[model samples]
Target: MCNGLLNPAQYREPQALADEHALIFARTWNFVGLLFEQEAGQHRGVKLGATSLIIQCDKQGRPRAFLNVCSHRHAQLCEQGVHRGPIRCPYHSWTYDREGIPAGIPQPQAFPEVIADKSAHRLKEFACETVGQFIFVRLSTDGPSLRDYLGPEYDFLLHASAGMNGLIDEFRQDVHANWKAVIENSLEGYHVPAVHNQTFMKVEGMERGHQAPVDTVQHPLHSSIDHPAAADWLVTFERKIAPKIGSWAWRFPHYTHHLIFPNLTVTSFLGYSFHIQRFEPSAVGITTVHSRTVSVGFTGQSPVGAKMVEQIYAESKSFTERVFAEDAAICRAVQQGLECAERPAVIGNGIEDRVLHFQRAYQRCMNPTSPPPPT
Candidate 1:
């Protein structure tokens, strides 16, 4: 960002990363995993910042998230996905129902007081919410509602990801760079022409492609890129599926990229296809990236139409992974460059304003004393 780059210590210092994990991510609604990816009656593990959690659908099929630790001995429960059954703690076999209620104990008579007070012994739950099948959890006790946090941009993101099919293709990479660098790389198109010269440049062309003029707008809790061709490539794809699944018209110059503060990137691929990416930091200069392409409102098509859509989805997924590989390598290099005792701040061209906005948001979160961006 041109305003002020984060100090090298911010990326290299363990203490700084810890503060960010707590202040920036844990306090906000952090996107975990897609709700649709999990089975109706099962438990799946997910991590947000430093907290490991278990997400499950109740008997009535409502989604819930709780700390993975068991109440008995605080042993991690359900390390992986498990089918319909009580969540039994491996340490003491204390069982929990779908609602995370303590259902059974080996010697119920011995601990009558503990058994009577079910609420205290139930799974430790975090504030959980969902937006268009994507699940988010906040470890902090209080904060703005997810809807309030997203502002009007919530509708914009919902439109982009509303009916995404089960995750079809996913590409995860352990990026050896600070999570912020990964996010900065995702926000700006300035590096596309140069960094993605071969992969993305081949399709969109040098001018009208990824390097094309980007009109960026910043909101209170999020920012977006207004790109004309965001939906152009999907015009044909949408038309083909329109007959089977009625017309789904999206506003022109559709959203090319949308960044929800801390860590969530929702980008439009074609008509109703969206790519969701999250940059999660595990430690200083270490991040785990989760990228997935899901089809929105795609279902009940003829065999031929389905096959064609699958082909397009696979091809596009491959292209995206290749582009991401390029970006990840560049981010690592940028991280390595930050090792200098004092480095020149990165100067973003006007086109990279989104990066500056993101940094501003990051600063606001890390240091609550700073003024927040104008809504």
Candidate 2:
């Protein structure tokens, strides 16, 4: 935490903020990382709170994760430090085999061959699952499947999650605010008209609300966004998406797959998204948020279709850039205000309740994992 550790009471329990995060987000599937248009053996690096993780293919070509630590002296086995390979530990010539196992100990007879048990020495693996084009890891291997966690929102993101081309167009921004602030900003469309003045004017957020379908779903994992009129419109416009996707779902706790319980919040209208912010709280008062743009159904379908999709995504990105700047400005100012407050409390409205919901949910985990979130 920026100052001392965060006040335990302020959150639900006494553990430090870092510990709580590992429990709620890290151990769970909290958007640990993503698998872009990467090949089976290609490697990519991602961070969870403060830890670095590598996602890559093993010699068997299976996806695996390791602490990125070298076996000999525990030096990081990576360069800057993630890339696909025949990875060679730079510390010593100690080479680890695929699957993160220490393949060989330099001198054969000096060390007992049994001392370097390939199975036991292998890189510690967290259970990994690929959902659509995204990748998720749970520190614990035995839990719900990713879909089981997604619950109801799965109906909406199925197709676009892969896009026709299976790629994600990304935009990253650093905001001087708490990670929670950015997540709260995205939960509801409450700020669309005012917070996004130019964006709203440029795009149409005329209808602002979460879909009723989300409330009714008991459990939905990967879903297709299905709106009758929107579906019809997509077909009507051959110049646009080959298929129409309409909903958002979630995998809970860590990652919201942009559908039901998505790790982040997203709004999609005419393939123009409001924002799906990914926040990294470097310190209590500092956070980095990435506003990633996803190219979906339309982009990969046809040349004309891809152009139209790109045009929409580009326009959406512009609006997001403008409005989010305002959000950053407000958050910066709020941090300064909190510095002086004694016991500050926030007022809540119908839409503002979303933030309260997240905070309450986070608090529940501090002492005992409270009840699972309502279906």
Candidate 3:
């Protein structure tokens, strides 16, 4: 059995939050948005920790990321949400090209120094990459590539992204809790009986004493849980309709939930649909959960098959929202308790092994030189 590696104070301390923003979030690849959904010449603003960023598609339809602030007077270039047209500064009408270079200056004669070296005044650019439809951004220039950072999850995400046709639903909620608290809650299923008793615990195969067997896979950067589908109706329906919709990827029906290191999770049932969620740290005690559900379809899916997929998506979306609400409420309570807590949390050896795996990874990043915790 392993104990929690993070100190209770780390959840509520301002300085600890700052250290995390710099050491963990900044140095890691953060999930931003879906590349396939963005229109050509569309740009949207996103926040990673305290850093503001703008993700846009260039003329060539390539995804690019840059600091949201204008190079001229430090004004924000675009507001949150998608915008069409050029990346123009609202303050002074300064505009930037796809490569972050200042292409148009209102008065070239006003500042000869800037005109002489336009490259020096370009918007600060960050690293951006995509695997299939998923897009990721990194603030630090020096680090592993997105593939290297994702480790074993890279190939899985690639296949998942390719199968996803489009987004079915999306929402964002600001929770009054530390970001770590929110993520930790998601890494284990021990709370299902209590926190999700009315929702998840009531699922066909998820009843208190009759739950299906679950297998946990742990890696240096990620962890996942796989279990056979317990819902008889869903499993039977999928098996019958899968051939018409697309080639079945797996021999048997199962549910998978994956945690991608720092603060992202991907969940699916039999690869038919994926629920992607990212826990973004907004402040010391505020975290925003950005969630979206995407449907998977094949090239020659029949009309009947498409309608069946839609029905499945509709039910999944409702179930997902209920479970998320339950999780958010419990996470808030956990954060409130941590405000006065002085001891480390206990880690169980069963379902919560993933939680321990995550905490150990966090400790490794936050204290690179420290000796590894005992197994």
Candidate 4:
């Protein structure tokens, strides 16, 4: 094994970053946002590596995605998400419906040739699909279906996200780091003691608390980690809300972490909450990370008067925000260290198996000769 590490040059080179965009981001199912983020008749602009897309729900509430560039002048239709109606080009009022078919033109008489073949000039569309409450887009037309690409781990993620609805919150910030640094930080729990010692360790009582060792399951496209809560937390929860908690803890058994190939990292926390973190690489050493959360309840609406459930949900959000902040800091620090030639090449121990797994999957995508890892 090469320790599943990329050299410092690989991390800093512009061409390598471009290759990553072409090989990985262009070809995979990238988590965009929760379905609730965009409303019917409204469009949201999202970027996947180098591709820009517009995700909108039609008047009939059907989801659609199109290249954000206008077909006529090639100007971006919208810089940011807008609420109201059909997408209209600011330059000439050229309008398109949710299906990306040209709907209107400022003056049909002025451009007979353009009007004669509107279909030929329709906005390009991308493949869009939803898993649970999350929306994902594939920049390329060809690839395995999102479900097949996700493989068996898709079901586990679906079950863990059952009843999840509208996004509760999302945190976005550009980090001065390579995307791999952010991905590596998320894939391994080994940094919890050092990077998150005061936050997660103190909160979970894992600093000195006796807890079952975390267990992990690996797949070609994904890997998951299941961590049991601290013994004291479980005992107290059982005493207070055993019936409400029911078989959830037993069935779920862990605060699971899944690093979905390409860009999404999802975590199921406390059996009632899940977070999807997307790492979007903007340049060789720049990444934009978005951390989003959703509530697990019927119809994306929180139940009324469920104080304990509310408490746990609120606490989970607070905990994730804190942990994410810690992770972002360390990822940036690692990015800085990676620029030094004297810095040691990366290596993953058993506890960082998911990190290795991610690197393997990434290599398979970026290298023509690298075999796809076992699914």
Residue 366 alpha-carbon offset, candidate 4, angstroms: 0.7
Backbone clashes, each candidate: 0, 33, 0, 0
Total backbone collisions, model 1? 0
Q: How many clashes in candidate 3?
A: 0
Q: Between which residue pairs do clashes occur in model 4? A: none
Best candidate, lDDT? 3
Worst 10 residues of 2 by lDDT: 247-256
At residue 175, give the lDDT of candidate 1.
90
lDDT of candidates 1 onward, in order: 0.75, 0.52, 0.83, 0.75
lDDT of 1 by residue, 1-375 (tens): 344546777878889888987798788988877877867756787778888888888877778889899888788887644445567788889988888988988988988888889877888888988777777888899998888888866687666555666666786678989898888888887787889988876764123544355655547458887665545455654576545544333434444778888898888743457788988887788888888887765555667766666776787788888898899899889888876547536756777778777777787888798676443
- Candidate 3 stretches with Cα past 4 Å from truth are 204-217, 231-235, 238-240, 243-252, 299-302
When 1 and 2 are scored with TM-score, the better candidate is: 1
Provide TM-scores for the models.
0.88, 0.72, 0.92, 0.89
After superposing all C-alphas onto the true structure, candidate 3 shows an RMSD in angstroms of 2.3
- In candidate 1, stretches whose alpha carbon ends up further than 4 angstroms from where it belongs are 1-3, 80-84, 204-212, 230-255, 298-304, 372-375
Number of the top TM-score candidate: 3
Q: How far in Å is the alpha carbon of 97 misplaced in model 2?
A: 4.1
